[model samples]
Target: MRPLIGVTTYREPARWSVWDQGAALVPESYVEAVERAGATAVLLPPQADAGRLVGVLDGLLLAGGADLDPARYGADPHPRTGAPQGARDTWEFDLLAAALGAGVPVLGVCRGMQLLNVALGGDLVQHLPDGSHQDPPARFVKTEVRTVGGSRIAAILGEDTQVNCYHHQAVARLGDGLRATARSADGVVEAVETDGPGFVVGVQWHPETDLSDLRLFEALVSAGKKG
Candidate 1:
């Protein structure tokens, strides 16, 4: 059976066609990327019992979304920081903790990466000036990231690679048991990984937006299969 990968999603007020209501949604790119990586993609919306699902899932994906509540890391919000989705923040945090506890493979993107850092007793930069990590609103900026020697990111994406970036906040201080594996030209932490047995990796880029390379997802699925 294909490994089941549970992806966290955004619960927000959405508008489509003539209908406008609160919904739990994630970009199709994330689902497609997971499916293309040879795994079964499952959307995990915010819930009181999200942690219970971790045991049955082969892997957990913390999909990119809104900025985390600064309170999570014991810091005041930056002036330029986006509004926080408190419920989603709490839900994803629980899911991440549960997945790690279960020793399941986990892949975190953009905001997901930041949350992982915060969850692991780290902090964030909060707000980056224009042209630092991101270009403009709704635009993806391309940048090259150099991977650490013998790191999981280096294994999948190689020592040097170009990636799609779209975030202002970044990992300021790495979490416990996590090591920085990749960095951009501006010195922002681009990727992090744990030395533990489980496959726990986080990247500041949006791999789902670039389907040309599915190695990252494939690696996650492969790790899930092993779990």
Candidate 2:
């Protein structure tokens, strides 16, 4: 059987045709990336049963979304910080905790990366100065990230790679048991990985948006197969 990869999604107000309502949504790019990497994609809506959900999945993929509420990391909101989606934040955090406890292979993208940092007791920079990590009007800015030697990111994307980024916040402190594995030219944390096995990794950029490499998702699937 193809490894089942559960991807966290956004629960937000959306519009479809004439109908406007709240829904669980994730960009199709994520699903395509997972499928391209030879895994079955499953969308996981925000809920309270993350522990239960993680038990059956072979891997977890935390898709990008809104900024986390700063309170999660013991800081007040920054004026430029995007509004938080409390339900999504709570659900994804629970999922990450459960997945980590279960030793599942996990990948976090963009906001998902920030969430991982905060969940592990690390704080964020809130808003990057002078739009270093993002361009104005929420556009994805292309930037190059240098990976650490012998790190997982380096192993996958080589030493230097161009990525698509669209965030104003970044990991400001190293999370417990995690280390920075990549950085942009401006010195923002671009990627992080846990010290042990099972492919626990996070990237500040959107690999799905890049579409040039499926190695990251492929690594997640390979790890999922080992379980």
Candidate 3:
């Protein structure tokens, strides 16, 4: 059976010609990436019940979105972090927690990666500016990252590969059951994953935007199949 992959969506207010309603939405690229990987993409509505998440899909992918509320990590909001979306934060956070508890495979890209870390008690830098910033700028430019052998991330990209990143906040401290598997110049956590099997990998980059070398999605799809 094609792996049933649950892709999370961002919640936003919508308007019709003469009416308005709240809606959950995701980008077409995300859905396309999943389908291209030979998996059936299921757009999981926001604020979904956590207990019900595991049964609907073999794996989950937390797609990118707005910055997380710094409060979730016990920090004063940074000036560059933008406004908080409390409802969205609560929804994704709860879903991530339940997904991990259920042992559902996961891949968190950019903001998604941060969410995974926060859910597991990790913290994030409220905002990142270069020079004095700890990690490399999320908008990495043709840079290579190093990965440890036998590491989950290493197994996906073969050796280290150049990736496209475009986020400011990044993993400051890792979450429980996850380890930093890859890093770049200036010491940014590039990738992370669970210690064991079932493929739970998160990258501080956007692999879907890098379709030229799509090993990332293929690996997720293959793992989802196994799950």
lDDT of each: 0.92, 0.91, 0.81
Native-to-model Cα distance after best TM-score fit, residue 80 in candidate 3, in Å: 0.8
lDDT per residue (tens digit) for residues 1-227 in model 1: 99999999988889999999999999999999999999999999998887679989999999998999999999998898888888899999999999988898999999988889999999999888777767776889898999999988998999899999999889998999999999998899999999956799999999999898999999999999998
- Residue 128 C-alpha lDDT in model 1: 81
Candidate 1 Cα RMSD after full superposition onto the native fold (Å)? 0.9
Strongest candidate by lDDT: 1
- lDDT per residue as tens, model 3, 98-200: 7777777788988999998998889998766753322444444555778878897897786677777777778998998889999877688889888876677
Model 2 lDDT tens row, 1-227:
99999999888889999999998889999999999999999999987789999999999999988899999999999998888788888899999999999999999999889989989889999888766777877688899999999999899989999999988889999788889999999899999999866689999999998556898999999999998
lDDT of 3 at 98: 76
**Candidates' TM-scores?**
0.98, 0.97, 0.88
lDDT of 1 at 176: 97
Off by over 4 Å in 3: 13-22, 130-142
Better of 2 and 3 by lDDT: 2
Task: Name the 10 consecutive residues with the lowest summed lDDT in model 1.
Answer: 128-137
lDDT of 2: 0.91
Which residue ranges in model 2 land beyond 4 Å of their true spot?
A: none
